[model samples]
Target: MSGAHGRRERPPAPEPLPAPTVDAHTHLDACGCEDAADVVAAMDRAAAVGVTRAVTIADDLAAARWAVQAAHWDERVTAAVALHPTRTAAVPEEWFAEIERLAGDPRVVAVGETGLDYYWDHSPPAAQQEWFRRHIDLAKRIGKPLMIHDRDAHEDVLRILREEGPPETVVFHCFSGDAAMARECAAAGYVLSFAGPVTFRNARDLQEAAVVVPEEQLLVETDAPFLTPHPHRGRANEPYCLPWTVRGLAALRGVTDERLATSARRNAERIFGLADVPPAAHPWTGGTDGARSA
Candidate 1:
């Protein structure tokens, strides 16, 4: 939990924005919320700052199941499920079937946090690409958006997405590409979901990339418990800190705080198909009965 300067805690919440928005991607589990009550408290903090809803994503099967229950427990949360690229190897075969089954649940909104991660050599590039294609196909089959995590493998990610044919709604989570790459993604109609990295002073290229994404193709996320934006970088992050990233993005895109929030919310609704209606609840109380019934 420790970050730069040996700090292990989050900073005070920034000033609230004037209108509500959705954190397109976040990881409530990594934030260490122990149970439904704990998750709701985190949501309350975020809602207080105009971040009224969030899509909690999973990096592996175990987390995906938790994400599904978390989403059903609260209307303000949605879930995205997928195996992280680095952790793809060593997973049991049933895990893939489980993920495919979970994808059918209305509470599970997207298939993601999936894609290549060349930054780490944990998984071979071939395995990552193979799993990425599987997830992409799954997203297409389920008719849900595809949330990608492309770290240091932009070209390969884009190439595979093209080769497999991207889903109707494709989102690049924590988009770290330059303006040219952003334009390439935009041309292919991919949504660029910016995270805390866009707020760093040295991320000028990323900032410029943010400016070119059409309002409808733009999104903002906390990617909570990591990438805690500028001025508070390295502090443990939670959804309440989204406003820092939102405001920073607004400054880059030359829009008012309310305008950016409004557009981001609209984009989230359109892509995720929420449109103000939460998915039907499929609550699981940690037993075979709930899982079986669902």
Candidate 2:
């Protein structure tokens, strides 16, 4: 149902997946989660649909702190801290220190949602590039994966990564590229995380790109509170909506949903070290419907 201003209502939860999956990138804080209980309820909904774990991204200092707290509060949630390229324009240089401090937490699994966002000119290109390099350095020094957010500046992003030498593992969150770019990233061994847009009927280029990604390097995300997948596009989104995206991607890749979910789960675990994390005692850990992950 449409609500005020005709904003589409949240879609009903889809059928649970055939196997466990992980929301490789998201923003629980943006999904209207205000406290531990909200976080728990969000994860509970995700767990119901076989999304066993999630990496909540922080785009600013405040979000970074909240992300870490969420990670520690609910074992199923993990954090990625950074200043989004758009936000980098106005934030003080000193704020980055807070991001760095938060990044060191064991609960924080990655350093990103950073990188260039040329599409939004909120930040001058120079400032965005400068901070992108700094975030890269932070990831390298701390030995965590660097999650990128390249928009309309893929070549520059790659060039900078090569210039500074990329961290051991790098991920392109909400990867928006065609087949050729996919090949370039795959060749460089950078993980590509497809989000809800992959389910859009008009996203032929992205669909083609998704098919070409090395199975091992492929990932899926919600990027929720935005980019809600097809049949429900323009609607509100959350981790629970991941099934539609996963199912769509699986179809494009010529695989069963279970196979894709299993792959995404394994890839996310390896990249984020989610396997070692234990969920809250009372909640379902990694499971399909009510069944636990093995």
Off by over 4 Å in 1: 1-7, 276-294
Q: What is the lDDT of residue 274 in candidate 1?
A: 81
Note the Cα lDDT for every prediction shown.
0.87, 0.87
lDDT string, candidate 2, 1-294, tens digits:
112312437799999999999998988877877667677888999999899889999988888877887787678889899999998777776798789988988888899889998888899999999999999999999999999999999889999999999999999999999999999999999999999999999999999999999999999999987899988998888899999999999999999999999999999999988766555333333332321111
When summed lDDT is taken over every stretch of 10 residues in candidate 2, the lowest stretch is 285-294
RMSD for each model, in Å, please?
Answer: 3.7, 5.7
Clashing pairs in 1: none
Which residue pairs show backbone clashes in model 2?
none
Worst 10 residues of 1 by lDDT: 285-294
TM-score to native of every candidate shown: 0.93, 0.92
User: What would the per-residue lDDT of candidate 1 be over residues 106-200, giving only the tens digit for each residue?
Assistant: 87778988999999999999989889999999999989899999999999999998899999999999999999999999999999999999999
